[model samples]
Target: EAGVTQFPSHSVIEKGQTVTLRCDPISGHDNLYWYRRVMGKEIKFLLHFVKESKQDESGMPNNRFLAERTGGTYSTLKVQPAELEDSGVYFCASNYGQGRAFFGQGTRLTVV
Candidate 1:
């Protein structure tokens, strides 16, 4: 099966603009996840999905962000009114092993 896929690969936008990132998990895999790293901090978990339902979203930062998995085949993470602090690498990963899995080439978001 194909591995996780992320689009754009990188993005640069001014503050207050909106950006959406996409991720497509491997076929037949029901587990997907999102993660991000800001500046030099350790990468942090953003959310997880199982089929079409979000299994865990405790890692979500705030209301300015939204994540959804339509039909459980692909997922999207939107950051509206992007902030300078939001500049970082966003990663998508998925697999059925119930642990750490394959990761897509992250989308690097730079806010000016």
Candidate 2:
């Protein structure tokens, strides 16, 4: 089974542009998570989805970012009016129940 897949491995956009990042987790995995490392800071957890519902989203920066997992199949993270401070590598991970998470190659976003 494929672990996890992320689209548009890299994105370069002007400030204020909108960018969407997608993540497809391993089949049958009910625990999905989103994480990121910004400006050499610790890789922080953005959110976690148990199936289609968001279980934890304490690390989300603000309202400009949104994340969704439709029907518990896949997830998408959208950033509206992207800012220079948002440039970083966004990572997605998944697990079956309580085991370790399997991470996808991150999507690098550069806001100019």
Candidate 3:
């Protein structure tokens, strides 16, 4: 029963560069979700994946951002040509029908 894990903890890049974030959910869990909060804004949902299928991705901001969960295990989120506004804490959460979800420490992306 490993907890969700994220990579890099923090990243700083130029306005036009690209960055990729990773997430590893707990074992035996089928639900994985990506979320973030920017500049005092509320935590927003990015997408949801159940197993190898994407259950929902309507929260994705634009084409510049992409998310994938391969083999229903760990997931990845890539931001291409990043922007300053993209600077924020990216969190990955997982739930297995449990009332509470586990979250990673989060990756703080700082696009300058």
Off by over 4 Å in 2: none
Candidate 1 deviant stretches above 4 angstroms: 97-100
Clashes of each: 0, 0, 0
Q: How much does candidate 3 score in TM-score?
A: 0.95
lDDT of 2: 0.95
Worst 10 residues of 2 by lDDT: 1-10
Task: Name the runs in model 3 displaced over 4 angstroms.
Answer: none
Please give, for residues 2-112, the per-residue lDDT of candidate 3 as tens digits. Answer: 688999899999999999999999887889999998979999999999887889999999999999888999999999989888999999999887547889999999998
lDDT of 2 by residue, 1-112 (tens): 7779998799999999999999999999999999989977999999999999999999899999999999999999999979999999999999989988999999999999
Could you estimate the TM-score for every candidate?
0.95, 0.97, 0.95
Against the reference, the lDDT scores of all candidates come to 0.92, 0.95, 0.91
TM-score of 2: 0.97
The C-alpha local distance difference test score for the whole of candidate 3 amounts to 0.91
lDDT of 1 by residue, 9-96 (tens): 9999999999999999888788999999998899999999998898999999998899999999999999998999999999999987
The local distance difference test score of model 1 is 0.92
**Candidate structures ordered by lDDT, highest first:** 2, 1, 3
Q: Summing lDDT over every window of 10 consecutive residues in candidate 3, give the lowest-scoring window.
A: 94-103
